[model samples]
Structure formats: C-alpha cells, structure tokens
Target chain A: MFGVTILGNNSAIPAYDRHPTAQVVTLNEQLFLLDCGEATQMQLSRYKVRRSRINYILISHLHGDHYFGLIGLITSMGLLGREHPLHIYAPAPLQGILQAQLDVAAIVLPFPLHFHALQQEGVLVAEDKFSIECFAVYHRIECWGFIIRENRKPRKINKEQALAYNIPGYFYERLKNGDDYEPRNGETVKNEWVTIPNTPGRSYAYCADTIFNPEVAAKIKGVTMAYHEATYLDNLIERAANRFHSTSKQAATIARLAGIKQLLIGHFSSKYEALEPFLTEAQSIFPNTQLALEGVSYRIL
Target chain B: MFGVTILGNNSAIPAYDRHPTAQVVTLNEQLFLLDCGEATQMQLSRYKVRRSRINYILISHLHGDHYFGLIGLITSMGLLGREHPLHIYAPAPLQGILQAQLDVAAIVLPFPLHFHALQQEGVLVAEDKFSIECFAVYHRIECWGFIIRENRKPRKINKEQALAYNIPGYFYERLKNGDDYEPRNGETVKNEWVTIPNTPGRSYAYCADTIFNPEVAAKIKGVTMAYHEATYLDNLIERAANRFHSTSKQAATIARLAGIKQLLIGHFSSKYEALEPFLTEAQSIFPNTQLALEGVSYRIL
Candidate 1:
C-alpha cells in the first residue's frame, strides 16, 4: 500500500493545538519521514506510527519548523537500540547540524547513517520498488519537492486460457514477462493471447514549503495525489508572497494544472484557528482537494 | 516566591505520558529556564508558563535531551515578535550550533541575544536580587551546576530604641549599614543598640546531570533545596558509573553531605516504568527527599 500520514500540519509557529510541519509517507512496509518538526517523535507515538519501520528521512529545508525534531528523534532511536542503517536525504548543511548535536551528546549510534546531499536539482535521491525524484522549489532557503512513484507490476496471466492451452507451470514466469513458449509437442502461442498488460502505477508528489509557481505544474503532471503547502488565505496574498509561501487558491491551481487526481493542502498559518476555509478555497478551484489534517491518512491510490 | 516548576521530568527518551528534562525557575515575576529539552515550548504552554516572561536560560550541557528545544523556542519567539532580549548561559559550542540554525532559516530576532559561555568553574553568571554561580560537574560532557542565592536584606532597626533616640529617616540608612549614628547635636548611638541583624537568605542549588561526586557537596553547601539527577537504581550501580550518572542512593548521599534542607531527584531511566523505588531508596539516606513529578511546584524555602 502507498499512503501518506500527516504528523503535523501547521506553519512556522507550533501552537498548543496545532503542530509544525511533519509527514510520514508509507511505501509498503518501509516508512519515509518528510520534514520532521519539533515533537514529531511524540506525534509518532501519539498516532501509533511504528518508528522502528522508518528507514529513510527526507528533509525539505533547514528551517527549524522543518527539521528541529531530527536530533531528538535520532537520539531516541539510539536509546531504543536501533541497529539497522538509516538513510537521510537533505540539503548539504543538515549533516553538519546533525553531526554537531550528536557529537556534543557523545552519542554513537549502533546503526550506520548514510547521508545523501541534495545539492543539485532534478536528481534521483532514492529508488527501489518505489522511486523518489527531487526537484527544486521556490522558497527562502534551498528546498526541494519529492515525486514518488511505485514500480509497475508484471502482467497478469489468464488462468483459464493458460489451462486450456495446457501450459506448463514452469512457463508461468515467462508468460508474465510477455513471453509465450511452446509445449513438447511444438504448439506455439502469442503472449498477448494469455496475458494482459499491467495497470499504470500510481504516483504522489509532495511540494514542500514553496511559493505558488506555475512551473511546478510541469513536474507533477498526472500524479495520483499531490500535497502542496497553502500557508495562508487569499486575504493574506501579499504576506504569503513575501514569505515565499502559497495560498489555498494558488495551490489548487497548481494541482488543477498538473492534472493530479487529488490535492491535499496544509502548512497553515498559526493565526488561523479554523482550517475549513482553506479546504473551501482550494475545493472551489479543484473539487478533489482536501485538508491535510494531523493524524489523518490518505491512500495514494 | 522562589521555587521551581517541573516542565519535564523524564529521562533521555521522551514517552507519550512523560517528557524530557525541563524546568521553570520562578523568582518573583522573572522566570529562568533550566535545561530545555525537546518540545519544551509546548510543555511551557501546557503548564501555562509564560514564555514571554522568561528572561534567562541556563543550559546544563549540550545533550539533545537538555538543549534541543532551544532553537525551536527561540524561533517561535521571533515569529511571535518578541521584543525583549534573551540571555542564554551555556557552553561555548552551543553558540555555533544556535547560530547555524538561525542562519539557515535567515531568522533574525527582534530582540538581542546575550550568549554567556561557561569556560571555567566558579564563574558568577548573573547577579541581581538573586546571585547565580556556576560550578563544573562530573559528566561525559562539559557540564555545570547552578547555585542561586537570594541576597541578604538590610538589618531592621529596633523601633522602640529608634523612637526613643529620635533617629531621623536619613540616619536610619547608616544604622542599617552597621554604622553608628551621630546626631547633629553630637550624640553618638551604637549601631548594635539601634538595629538588629537581618535574617539569613535562602538558596537553591541545581546539580544537573551529574555523577555522585564528593566535590559537588562543597559547592552546594547549606542550600535550602537541591535538585539532583538520579538516573538509575542501586542495582544498576555499574551502569550508572559507566554512564557518568548517579543512582537514587548516591544522589541522597550527596544531598546529605551538602546539608540541604530538601532534595528533589529525577531523570529516571527509561527501562523502569515505576519511580516509587527511586523515592524509597533516596529517603533511606535523606529523609527530606522527594521525587520530581512533572507539573509539580516545589518551594525552595
């Protein structure tokens, strides 16, 4: 299953009720953390997210609201006796910060830490059954948005057709790979006659901490789900632009232009007590829009 | 008026029900933070401690459990448009770490930040109605303990003697300063006959994150209240020694040696779910010992 869980959704200042920016993206059994804000570990525990399964962390920027919880989480992992290697992908400067904190505390993790610096734009940071591509976003600091796509599955074979043709069990693998074989009697068959092509894989794009830029529409085209930051309302359009952040309408416009199936918007200003207006404004432009509420889970499909 | 409010009392690993180390030292209207752990700003809000009134912050060490919340707190203060200057007393390396985070986010506080580095032992960090002194402690890192003493008040004059001698208001100041009063008529009055000595002031010592070291007893002698770390039980004596931490018995012994009126011990290991044993073990050595419960206020006098 491919999905994303909102750990925290508020902007710069974390309030008593709303928290800062943090999200957990689940790809099958492995979990990938996106932008760990302060109290993210608590949020993980509060929401019952198993932190032991997290193998990768992706930091969008160096803002405190984006990554302040990193040191605490790393320390907790060590204390909990995590032995598996953890991978971190972020801007180059984050390594120095993390190293300094660990060094001061005299903490030596049992697990190996592999840091992949996102110095240049349009690079593939990680890939496996799922591929994550990083692209530049317009922000006050160096920030990048991630596009995650699940690998396509093998073609499915028609059991009735294969059985009627008397295909051997050993030839099933070849048939799924679009190859058809003849039996000992030299009977031949076309691969398309028994197997159907696999369905298109789903894709999700996370546009982290960015201003409303039409250029982003080209990068996230045809995605199944897209999470764009909408930190303010239309009334605070000038303030949003000054802070290099997007509004609800602008985020929805990008999702509409990108042809994404669903749009989830969050990172609201602390001044906003109610988030219904954000959903209303975005849904006016894109009917498939939803609010990124904390502890809420959205399936990628 | 002189007391401490426990903001967080848990050990290194923060649990959902408990938090990491943090305390608010309230001296009249001013508030001083002691060991701000991760999410301390939220803890401050949860306990209704006014973060805006905090004028000073004392960092015991560079452990993430002690100072990780500082950057987020400072960032939130700036975002809230705090105009008052904040003073931070910590080791030298913290300055670079704090500056790097601030530089990355391009956040400039509206108030001035005065960073006082603890280089040598027995340095007086602050002096006002209460004098703060710092002394080195036995820890894995360069840690320091703080001693806060309320300044002694002037000696009170004997009202009956003063009225009979017709002492003027101008001359009362000299009498309080231990000087004999000489009237304009050339009559000399002995200072002891006119004024009585003031009462001795109270003091609180915070021996934060330290091992059971005898040297600390001399520095915290005659303190009214002492807050020491008891990270393990007697059974884990070897582990406590290896980690440069103290057990409940060791902390109680130090409190007894220091002759403190009351002892508050905390920083329980995460391995143990209950804290009753800590209090029991400590009270065996020091009868005035108490456990540091979160959100609880303890009087220094």
Candidate 2:
C-alpha cells in the first residue's frame, strides 16, 4: 500500500528524454508530491497520476529544477476546477514567490492552499496515521530531507478468548489496547490471553537534493526504503561536491551506513548519456541499491 | 528564412504529447523565442533548436505558462557555458522575478543579460538590420505584441555607369543612400542613372496572448505574417473573454482586419482533442490561416 513513483529523475538541466527531479509517494489512498520540476504536470498525466488525488507537496528547496512547475500545476488545478484543499511544505521564501505569481495573474483559487514553512531542521512537519519529519541536508540553498513513517496499528484481539470469557463486544477495544477486561462479576482477564502485539510499521526516507553527509546516515537508519540523490558518477566527485550534490557511490555509502532495507538512487547528472554506470557504481557500494527509473514504482516493504 | 518553429503549443496545462506556449522565429541565422513555457529548454532540445542561437526572448506577460521556462533555460545555458548575450523584453515586473530567481541560484552569467521593459505601445524595442517594435495588446496583464521588420537594402549600382562617371568606392555608400554623385572632374551622376530602388522588406508580427481588439489590428497592419493566439473555441467565447483570450474566430478576425498576408494560430485549449475545428473556423474568416503545429515550420513568404 506504500510506494514511490518516479516522475522525473534527471538532475541539473532537464534533457529532451529525461526530466528534472520529481516523484510521487503513494501512502495508501493519499498522494504526496516530492520536488515538482518543470514539466511535472505533464509527467503526472503521462504516468496516469490523477492531479486531484495529490493533497500534499513537499518541496526541498527554492531551486528552479525543484519547484518551477509548482505554480503551473496549481494554476492548472484551478483551471480544471479542482475543489480539494492542498497543503505545501517548503522554505518560507516559496510562499512569497507563489503569492506574487498568483496575484499577477489575478487568479482566485476555488480551494484552500495551506503553506507550512520549514524554518528549522528536525521538526515534525505533519503527523496522522502517517507521520512526516524534516531535517536539514547539505545543499547550495536551504533544503531538507523527509522521513515518513506509517503509524502502527493496535494489537489484534483473540475473539475466541474473549468469547470464552463471556466478554461483550464493548470490551474488545480494551483487549486490542493490551488491556485486560473485568466483567461485572469481578472476574479478571489476562492481557496475554486476549491479544497479540501489533506488527512493526514500515518507514521511508527521502533525502532530497543533498551532498554526501555522514550526519544524515543516523537519521535515516533502519528505514524500509530510502531515496537518495546520486547526481554524478564516482569520477565526477569533485564536480558533485562543487555543485553541492552527491555521487552514485556516495548515495550508496549513505544507504549502506544507514542500514536501510533498500536504496533508490536517482537525479542523474545531465552530462551522463547513460545510467548504467550510476547503477554499477551504487551497487558496488550497496548491493541493495536500484536505479530510480521514471514511471517505475517501488514498494516500501 | 522567415519562419516560426513550434517549440510548445499547449495551453496552461501541458500534456504529455503537447507543451505550453513557446515558439522560435527563425530569420536566417537568427532565432527569437516567443512565450517560453515550462520545460521549454527540453522542448528546444526536442525540436533540435540550438539553444545558443536564441538571442532574444519576448515574454507576453507574467503568466507562469508564458515565462516560467525562461529561468530554467537561462540556467541551462549557463551550465552549458554559453557566452552569447541574451536579451529579454517583457513588462517591468518580469525583470524583478527573473533577477530574484537568478539571485537565488547564485548564478553569474558568462554573458550579459539585458532586460528591456515594455511599458507602452509603440516603436523600437530593438532596431538594427532587424527592427523590433512592441505594440499594446489587450490581455489581463500588461502585454505587448512584437513586430520584427527586416530592414530593406538599397539597390545595386550599375557598374558601367559608375565606371564611366569615375565614382569612387567611398562614394558608393552615398550612392546607395540615394545621393547624386559629383566626380572630382566636375562630372555629375544622377541618382537614378546608377542605382535602382531597393526591394521591400519582410516583416513578421507576434500577437502574443491577447483578446481580439481592433486597436491591435491597426498596429499590426500589413505584416507579412502574423502569429495569433487561439486559446478557445466559439462555444467557450464567454470563457475566453473572461480569461482575456481569443477563439480561432477572433484570431482570424484580427488577421483579416490587419490585412496580414498569412496567419498562424495556436495555444489551443486542452479540452480540444483535435485542431481541425480551429483551422476550419479560422480559415472561414481568413483563408490564409494555418494551425501552428509543433515541430512544423511555416515560411512567412
């Protein structure tokens, strides 16, 4: 039920065949966007991702490659008569930029748009059945990585045990919560006889637009899946550093150090004509690494 | 050599097969961009238009679909190490937006970027061998249409008559300027005896994002070719009016009234699955009208 869909994977300048950074994370029925590059709207349509289904967007930085398509997407949603409220989480500067563009066009949205500013690192941006946390990453501008964790469900109650104890339906809730029930006759019930512990929740981390920083490894440790940017080859390590980006090997190193179950590496530099070298480089360091190909979906579990 | 190459032709919402508004006007070796939509850099590459050859960009307004691609394109050019100066002509507000984006990226151009503000309707945004003039257009924002006129050359001189009159090579410039020449030996050369009048110049007018207005017609009168926006169909006339856009019929009306030699209409509504109706509707009023098909080039002559 939890997965990530790649909309665009190329880094820096978008090429004719490859687009800039953009991805869609589907958590159950809800959709959240990550880094909307130019042509993201087209990519969404190309992948058959319903624009109306997207309720939240997470922007990593103010770079054009990361957020240029946001205004266009918002405008198109308005034009299409989308009535669903949308929330965007990004740096505070993005609000002014979006507001100025909207004001210039004299457009009034039919739905509400909420902007949540990511002013400091290590803040819990949103939490519900799924929780999202933001932490700073090393980039040319202000940027953050996100960790999304699904909330664990309560333990399952043993119906046979409850029935044998002559417990009513109302007492089943207490059993699921690891609480033992007492009947009106003062008969006690053991917790172990009624319920079993809940299964562990899966987690996914998105390290958006950042250079290789060892500090991030601890924060993303033991996640089910992690999407780390690999914007350059190992040979271009200096170039990657100069651009405040990471090489394929560096991305794999982070994933390996974090002990993540699987690694998805993308954001290939535009200078690269083929992606085989990136995969080779990353897999050499982390055997569980995979290339982030466009339109491909990867399950969290 | 006077033709327009469709870089992008879709409306605000870009489709997988179609893009937002963007086109390239090719005048011999020179290229001028019109309405740079999102992902225009990729579109330019897809259409095989040399990014280095684009010297001028004319923005119609502050709409995201019209100018969002500009920053990305500029950034790409910078990354590619392009040294050619780029000139952008748009309303005053656009300068701030573009500058802010460039500043955010901390990009210093290898070439100069000149911003010309178009505040009013009239003569001369740029004048050289090719003269560019901006005329007021009826749009929701402060918009202008561009008229590019290739300067006419003077007629060739009669070699035999020039030799007989012993006209110096230095006097050839004067002779081309339609002045009678007097030789050092007191011989007079009549202006008409040695040179014939020059041929008429070619002109192309870009009527960007606008509603049909009679005033626009008069300003663009006698243009050899005109590119007009047809954003909606007749059934959506009310919507077009509300959006300050034109239907195919309205675009044709302006072309017909302006007495243009030919008309190219694009920026079709995404609701339209086919463009036959637009061409048919426009040609009903102006027989020379043609649909602006992407990747298709149309000669002005």
Candidate 3:
C-alpha cells in the first residue's frame, strides 16, 4: 500500500480539468498530504480518500497554489470533530498565515495543530513505519523537496514449514515480527527455519517546483520512485528556466541521471491542453517516465 | 442583462452533489462575485463565467466555506495577468490574513487590490449602472448581506411614433435617453410624443447565513428577487435556531413578508442527500420560490 495518489497535476493556474499541486502518499492505513492546493479537500472527497486519516501535511513552499487549501482543510477537519493532533511541515512563514486565518474566522480547532518549520535538508519525521526527509530545490523562492522511505518489512512466514513445526496459526502475526517459535514441549525454533527475508523497503522522492538543476539528481539518487515537476515542454525550455521551472526533457534527464525506478512527472503548464506531448517528450529521454494524472495512484512498490 | 448565477449552494460542508456558498451577480459584461468558497474558481470555470470580468468580490462572512477561495482566486487572477484593479469587501480581519499570506508567498499582484472592510450598514459601492449596499445579518460571527440595485433606466422609444415625427435613425439612441428632437424648421418635438416610460429597475438582496429573524424582511423590503439561507428543512427548526440558521419555511416567510417578486433559497445543510424537499417546503410557504441550482442563472428583467 505504499503509493502516491495524484489529487491535482496542473501548475500555478488550474485549467483544462487539471488542478494545482496536491497529492496523497498512502502507507497502509495512514495518509500524508503533499502540497495541499485549491480544491484539494474536494479532490479528497471526490476520490474517496479519508480526510481523517491525513495526520501529516508537507508543503514545499509558500506559493498560494501550493498551500492555499490548507486553511480550509484544517477548518473542515475541526468541524468534522477530529481530536487527533495534526502536524504541518512547511516553510516558517506558514505558521503566521495559518494563525491569522484561524483567528480571523474565530475557529478553535477540536484538535491541536503542530507546526514544523522546514529549515535545512534533514529528516522531518522519523517513525517506526517510515521516515520523511527534506532537500533543497532551485526555485524562484526558498523551496524544498521531500523523500519518504518506508521501513523494511519483517520476514514472511512459510505456512507449510510453520505447520510442520507445530506452530499454531495464531502465532503467525508474532512470527512476521521476527519472533522465534516456542512449542509446549520446550523445543525452540529459530526464526530463519520457516521465514524468508523481505525485499528492500521502497522510497519515494518528491522534487517540487524546481528548475533544471543537476544537483536534484544527486539529492534524490537511487529512489524507488521519483516525482518531478515538468511544468513546460522542450519548446518552452527558456520560459521554464526563467520561471524557475523544469521542462519535460529536463525532468526526464534528472530522473534518468538519478537512476530512479520510475519517474512521475506533473505540474504541467495550463497552456498545453493536450498532455500526450509531455509523455512523448519525456519518454523519448527516459523510458520509465509516467504522466501524473488526477485520481490515479502510482505504487512505489 | 442583469442576473445572478449560482456557483455553489450548500452549507458549511460541501457534500453529495452540493458545494459551499458562492454566486456570480452578472451585470452585462461585468460580474460581481459573492461569497467565494472552496472550488468556487472551479465552478466559475465550469460554468464558463469570465473570471477576468469579475472586478468586485463580496465576502459575507469569515466562515471558511464563504471566503476560503478568495486568496486562490486572487492568486490565479494574478497568474492570469489581470491588469484591472480588483475590489474586495469583507471584515477587517480578512485584510491581515490576506496580507500575511501574500507576504509569505511574495506575491505582488499585477493589478491593484482594493480592500473595503464592511464596518457599517450602508452603500458599499455606487456606480452609474448599479449600487451595492451591506446590512447586518444574525450569524454566529459578524456577517453582512448585500443588496444589488440596478439604476433607473431611461424611457423606451416608440419606433412608429418616432418615424411619424421624421426623426433620423441616429437620433434613436438619444431618444432612448429621453432627449427631445428638433427639425431644421425649428419645430421642437416633445420626448413623450415618441417615447414611453421605462419599466422599474430590478433589485436583488442576499440574506447570507442568518437566523429566522422577522426584522430581515424590513431591511430587504420590495426587492425584485431575494436569496436567503435555508440551511435546514422545517423538521430541524430547533437545530436551525440553535445554529443561528434559517429553515426553508423561515426563508420563504421572510421573502414573502418582504414583498419579493421571487425567492431563491440555498445554503442547504449537507446532512440531507435529497434537495427536492427544501424546494417543496419553501414553495409551500412562498409560491414564487425557486431552488438555487449551481450553474443556473436567474435573470432579473
């Protein structure tokens, strides 16, 4: 269940049935919001993603299209009687903006809001299940990217081998946690006897709102899946560079250089009504590129 | 043509097929946005309303469902390269919130932003074609309703009578302005001889997020069309009162007592999946009642 669902894929202005930047990274039952833009909550409702399960929000920058929907989503969560504390990780200035909006509306949340200002390139959240880290990106303003690494799963049990060893079905849950089996006859079985090691944990990196920078490839090197902003086509390479955005070719180049297993490209400019050209252009450079479409989820593993 | 286009028609939470409150008051080529909520810009785009033509935005309250989309719309307008100045009318606290967001985002609008805080019950805007007035409403927070009154039109020209008078075709425009005609022979023609009095101008009042207050009828007396919040049906009268909201029956009663030609009831509570009951209940009280459907325009002729 380690996947990312696209809520909106358009760039600054939402057009042509495309919305601004917003995504939901799903890990089992937990959901983490990435860059909540306008209509993010509506998208969540439309896509049937449980808003109550979204306890953490990661905002890349202070752009209005990136985080304008945060206030409304937070307020709606309060109205929905959410008592679970919410955590928001963004640039430092977001706290003042959120506070002013809450105070103006006289909204006293039913839950506490924890704000974590992203300052340097380091881990923002480290839990037993996963960890999220931030890295710098070359944008017009100060911005950062995020990488989420899910913790490695425990060994898988061989049901036939476990049955032969007289292990009850109830003990399977503990066995998956790398616990050794103990029979009533005082015979202790090693964990390796009936279990096989799990594959490596998956990692996904989100390179938000960046220009064509080679450093990005080095920062997100060797990720299982990578999402890059391809705001323009190759024809608008100069425009993309001037606006601190990346072209489809540029995004693909970075993904190919980083050796990512898959590249999800989005944040498309509203000018391009047809999206086929983006896929065609990126695929010509990197065969593993995929278009980030609304309501579509790309599994990291 | 003067009309009111419904953008959203639900209460605090957007659910089912209904959205939060938002409307566009159309006056010929210009538009006046009223209470922009979440997904309002999307609604505007969906309904094919020219967002660039919207020069004025009126927020009735500080509720997130009423004004959360304002900042997004403004930012989008800037991104779309709007050069015309935009006017916004809301409570005083909204300025601080908007400013903090803009400061953090470092967004300098290409167009000027004119902010008018709604402090008193008086005329907020008075133009040659129309005038807008604000009045207090009974809500949980400080709120106001708006009245858009079209200016008195000139006399309608009688074509046959003008032809008999031998008036030139070029003089018809002036004749509609109530101008007298004179021939080269120096014989003055009276305006009444070739013109008839124009019909009375139309007035529409928006009673935003209010309780079942009988006093509201007096404030919006004699309006051509009136829109009032019907957040609940007759069965939830007690709940409506507790939440400082009006039921469908209450809304219709206010419209009937105000001598309105037609009543438009909206701001439906999201708890109800079906909306036909609201219209049925309101029409039973006021025969000229209509349910405000999104994307539908109610012409005031």
On lDDT, the candidate that comes out on top is 3
Write model 1 residue lDDT over A1-301, tens digit each, in one string.
8999999999988874788899999989879899899999999999999998998898999988889998899889988999998988989988998998888777898888888999776646546477778888999989999887887777899999988888888899999877877767776888888888898788889999998899899889899999999999999989999999999999999999999999999999988998999999999999999899999999988
How well is each residue in A26-82 modelled by candidate 3, as lDDT tens digits? 988889999999889889999999999998899999998899889889998988899
Task: List the lowest-lDDT window of 10 residues for candidate 1 chain A.
Answer: A119-128
lDDT by residue for model 2 (A62-167), tens: 8888888888899999988999899999888788778877877778989899999997766465465787878899999888898888877778887787788788
Ranking by lDDT: 3, 1, 2
Show model 3 residue runs off by greater than 4 Å: A155-198, B155-197
lDDT of 1 by residue, B1-301 (tens): 9999998888898864688899988988878899899999988888889999998899999988899999999988888889989999999999999999998777888989999998877756546577788889999989999987787767899989998888888888888878898877877988988899898778888888988899998889998999999999999999999999999999999999999899999888888889999999999999999899899999988
Model 2, docking class: medium
Candidate 3 C-alpha error for residue A249, in Å: 1.3
Looking at model 1, give its docking quality level.
high
Computed on C-alphas against the true complex, the DockQ of each candidate is 0.83, 0.67, 0.57
| TM-score ranking, high to low | 2, 1, 3
Error of 3 at A12 (Å): 0.8
Q: Candidate 2, B56: how far from true, in Å?
A: 1.1
What's model 1's lDDT at B52? 96
